[model samples]
Target: MLELRPNCECCDRDLPPQSAEARICTYECTFCASCAETVFAGVCPNCGGNFVPRPIRPENKLLKDPASTKRQLRSAPCGARTAA
Candidate 1:
């Protein structure tokens, strides 16, 4: 299941469960659509891959896996780090 990360990895912008602006790379390197297309040119700084909007997990699953228990956000994970 998708982790449904809670925020933009780079700017710390909120990306709640229903957010339509959250973008991700092939590796799921999360970012905001604004930053993805403008600041980063659709390049995932941590993945060197194209950016696309992340899928929203169904809210019904909240009873199962639950959202993140903390407000912590993270930058993209390691694997394909590239120059910003």
Candidate 2:
């Protein structure tokens, strides 16, 4: 299941469970669409992978499988480090 992280790792922007602006990599690294596109150019800095829009879990299903409240932030600002 997707962790549906609560915030963008790059800019620390709030991304609620249903936010259309949320983007994620295969590793589940989450970021806002702005960071994912403009800052990172659709590439995940942490995993060197492409990003895709995060799926929103249905409201009913969310009760059982809740969106993650744990927010993840990168140690450095967006684009601060080069992909390995």
Candidate 3:
């Protein structure tokens, strides 16, 4: 199951469970679409993998499988440390 991370790791932007702007990598590293497109150029900074839109967990299902509240806010831009 997707962790449905609550915010952008790069910019600390709020990304609710249903946000269409959330992009994620296979490792589930989450970023906002802006960051994914502009900063990382569709590549995941943490994993060197391409990003895809994060799926929205249905509201009803979210009750049982809650979106993660643990925000992975970063102090520096993710693109600065691109995966080797």
Candidate 4:
């Protein structure tokens, strides 16, 4: 399952797993739409693949399994929010 990361890796914006601004690559490296579009040019820094909007984690589990709260990375937010 995706970590449903709480913040964008590039802008430190709250993602909350439901925000349309959240973007992710195949590896689920998270960023905000602004960063993904402007700073990254749709290419993930960690992975060269293009990004897509992150799917929202449901409020209630529809299946037996559920997502975990583990964070995969916490790199410094790239540059400034204005860049995003």
lDDT of 4 by residue, 1-84 (tens): 776776677666777755788898998888888888888899988878999998876667524545445544446455575433
C-alpha displacement of 60 in model 2, angstroms?
Answer: 0.4
C-alpha lDDT of all candidate models, in order? 0.71, 0.88, 0.87, 0.73
Model 3, 1-84: lDDT tens digits are: 999999888877889999999999999999999889998898887889999999888899999999999989666656554421
Candidate 3: segments with Cα more than 4 A from true spot: 79-84
**The candidate that achieves the highest TM-score relative to the unseen native structure:** 2
What would you estimate as the lDDT of candidate 1? 0.71
* TM-score quality measure for candidate 4: 0.75
Least accurate stretch of 10 residues (summed lDDT) in model 1? 75-84
Any residue pairs clashing in model 1, and if so which? none
Ranking by lDDT: 2, 3, 4, 1
Clashing pairs for predicted structure model 4, backbone only: none
Kindly report which residue stretches of model 1 are placed more than 4 angstroms away from their true locations once superposed: 69-84
Better of 1 and 2 by TM-score: 2
* Top lDDT model: 2
Model 2: per-residue lDDT, tens digit, 8-77? 8987889999899999999999999988998999999999999999999889999999999998889866
Instruction: Please state the error at residue 55 of candidate 4 in Å.
Output: 0.7
* Model 2 segments more than 4 A misplaced: 79-84
Q: Any runs in candidate 4 off by more than 4 Å, and if so which?
A: 62-77, 81-84
